[model samples]
Target: MPVMNPMQEPCSIMAQPPFRSFLVPGQPVSHPDHPEWGEGVVQSAVGHRVTVMFPHAGKVVVNATVVHLTELS
Candidate 1:
């Protein structure tokens, strides 16, 4: 079988920030669509994608455009 290699970007580029996103690392948030995931802490936020560490759901990536994460105080 012929070996295949994944395509790589010519250059690295920064992603555009999500509109009206106030999420940050270590900030607590909850998923409105999936309450079962319970309260989660923000692991990383880049562009519209947010990495949340949930107690029940473990680590999950969510799109801020589709589901607005509820920020906890």
Candidate 2:
């Protein structure tokens, strides 16, 4: 049997309503779970994963579905 690439597979979560509020690159964000990390800027947003650059925590990858990152105005 051929193996299916997960990336190519359709993500059901992406179709959900809350998924519409995904963040984009360069957007400022803050992680409530890790407030000590301070505010961070979104470096990349792919699928359900987001890479954020935090001053204290450095680059961290978080699950968009679970994290619910706060967008900084």
Candidate 3:
């Protein structure tokens, strides 16, 4: 039997910002297309957008400036 090396593939370069400890209070986050899928805490923020992870829906990335969010104590 002969041994073979693993195949490699090229991927797109996505510029992501560093994680910061900041949360806005009473922020409304909604999806660009579907507003009903928008709900939950701000899991992470990147630039003008934040990843909203809901308890029932899951996760949806939305604009931080538009979504009204609040920090949970």
Best by TM-score: 2
Candidate 3: regions farther than 4 A off = 1-21, 24-41
Q: In lDDT terms, how accurate is model 2?
A: 0.89
**lDDT digits (tens) for residues 1-73 of candidate 2:** 6777977865686886544437999999999888999999999998888999999999999998788999999
Candidate that beats the other on lDDT, 1 or 3, i.e. the better one:
1
Residue-wise C-alpha lDDT for candidate 1, range 46-72, written one tens digit per residue: 878889999999999988889889999
Off by over 4 Å in 2: 1-21
Backbone clashes in model 1, listed as residue pairs: none
lDDT at position 60, candidate 2: 98
Task: Compose the digit string of candidate 3's lDDT tens values, residues 1-24.
Answer: 555556743333345454443554
Collision count for each candidate, in order: 0, 0, 6
Per lDDT, what order, best first?
A: 2, 1, 3
Candidate 2: TM-score? 0.71
Each candidate: what lDDT? 0.86, 0.89, 0.56
Model 2: weakest 10-residue lDDT segment is 13-22
